[model samples]
Target: MSENRIYLASKSPRRKELLQQVGIAYEVLLLRDAPPRGPDVTEIVLPGEKPQAYVARVTQEKADMAWKVIQLRGLPQRPVLAADTTVVLGEQILGKPANRDAAIAMLSQLAGQTHQVLTSIAVRSALGLHTVTQCSDVSFAAMNQAEIAAYCDTSEPYDKAGGYGIQGAAARYIANIRGSYSGIMGLPIFETCQLLEAAGVRTTTDRSL
Candidate 1:
């Protein structure tokens, strides 16, 4: 395991849980207390930005923003980890639903369709900063309006990108996936572990490298 302490720059419990699953000890650093970045920076997808580009850009932006926060606050400068997830349908990329109506529309479009889930994680440490992108192909069964409405009523889809979560109640809608299941859930263990290790975030499985 890494002898160095880790500072997680995210509020996602799933990421925390995933880190713990891999035996990586870390401390949480919420952005709320990390000072504001002027205002809520609407993560821009940019004009004609592809899903891969958007995902990687956001992940780096988040890590870079958090690094600035650490420097400004003089917080214990440990490795800062950040990530972003997106759902891509053909050339159109679907991010989090802006409202209930948007949620319904997104779910309807995703009904009985296969979409690409792209997750990017960036790790910043004393060694340097490294970013990794993981892609997953997820297929969903055709769903009715009632199904979409019922799922939307819960807390599952609102905060998740692509309007759904593979590990949440929305799991029932997924028929098959062709990539990292954990990536769809938000973080891919294989890629995340690799990035962390490269950034000098030590783990028990040192020999795996």
Candidate 2:
């Protein structure tokens, strides 16, 4: 891998920290003027767009957008990475809350229920784009208004999918997790490594420098 060929198409601190934790040196590739948040509210998933399909579509779109940015900027070609995460309760897909009231309602609905966290990561290289989607089932213990309000008052849940973060104070509400913990946090470490490795995004210091 070239020293400057790795680009993270996101500004997510969690995603950045995860990549850095594994010693992967990368530059940020912002997808759009506004940060790439949850599901594109305006994107109408086709009639048969299942959760997995919807997520894959968005993930690929984000990765492709980053690639377009790099191309438009006329920077030396390199690999760009992008990802999307969604929280689902049965057939209902939950995105970031629209407001405090919506957040409270989502939290209320999630209390004492189990939901699936799906995180998909994509990488675009000269060869082609690679992607991986990981799913983890998380169970949340019952939460009261006090607990929800306390967690919501902070910035932890607002930006995260499902309106809660597994690594933050919201951890208190999670009874247990059955998949990649990092996935719930936004990026699946194992799957992300797979995508990077496949795209030749090496983590060895030998390559980073």
Candidate 3:
């Protein structure tokens, strides 16, 4: 592996695309597909855990687990990058919806409301593990039952946080966004570049430096 490449510890295609967009070469670590005996990073929110805490903890665990996998598999030594995204309305954390009805309910609640999209990233390098969380405020237009149901009927809402993908059909419902758009998608490019640079990995954006 080249020194410019790192290990991406996520299965999200959005994350992969974001890295590719920035010319940050990475090899997918596929943590979930690792050996059955390997540790898995559970997304369960502990009792009384705040959204920020939960996201940060999960991101760190993912990076840690990826690092362990590297040692176990004898893969090349490189920085391990991991991230976790969650949608938060009030104090409640909205994770991926289980089914069509749940997706509809989540979209219904988010309609005409402003919610927070929290994406936490962790990078484990020779120096140690580093993490950062980016919070973006997304406001949705008022959506009618038919609109919500129609969106729920599509496959876009099933695998994404808050039961919607901001980059997909759900973009029509987004009224405004106050933070990093890439953060809302899954990875915050600015913060990700900062972490990768700190780990001695160069991105295309580093060319001007």
Candidate 4:
């Protein structure tokens, strides 16, 4: 049993890649699919809930749920990590787009403006649950209808918050960024490292890699 391994509760490829990049040993925890009519929605922003609070709540909830799964499955006793990211423009929180039109609308609103990207990472262990939220400002250059249309054609916007990914073709559309780049990708490296460390998970740096 590797003492450095933790259970990751996210299915995000980006999160997996980020963990690998940081040399954090992790095992993906498979969650049962939610039924279509279930009331277990994780993205319903409460009335008057701020973006920061919403993301933090959701991330902790994910970590809590993942921990429960670990106990149920009798998986190896290890810390479980989960994260959530959202894009905020003013008071509105832009979540993952539901369709092409929605994606286009999101990108359109984000064009020529700066928005906040909030990523909350949570880790649960026998000691308890620990969490951190990191915020970053991303500025998008003014984009025309043609540019938006062409980018939307690739369907990259559909899976990302704010309808654009800073690491992808949308990179050309970004004018500036003032925070952790990994936070925009889904997991904020610094904040994630802090949470993992607090949960007693040794990081790559601790191993002197």
Highest lDDT, which number? 3
- Write model 4 residue lDDT over 1-209, tens digit each, in one string: 35888988888899999999999988997666432221242679989899999999998888888877777666788999988999999989998888878888888999999999999998999989898899999999999989988898886888888888888999998999999999999999888888888887777565564
Report lDDT per candidate.
0.83, 0.82, 0.92, 0.87
Error of 4 at 99 (Å): 1.5
Ranking by lDDT: 3, 4, 1, 2
Candidate 1, residues 42-79: lDDT per residue as tens digits? Answer: 57889988889988998887787777777777777788
Error of 4 at 165 (Å): 0.9
99-202 per-residue lDDT for model 2 (tens digits): 78778888998999999998988989998989889999999999989988877788776887888888888888789899999898888988887787788766
Better of 1 and 4 by lDDT: 4
The candidate 3 region of ten consecutive residues with least summed lDDT is: 31-40
* Cα error, candidate 4, residue 191 (Å): 1.3
Model 4: CA > 4 A from native: 33-41, 205-209
lDDT of 2 at 103: 83
The model with the greatest TM-score is 3
Worst 10 residues of 1 by lDDT: 33-42
TM per prediction: 0.90, 0.89, 0.96, 0.93
lDDT of 3: 0.92
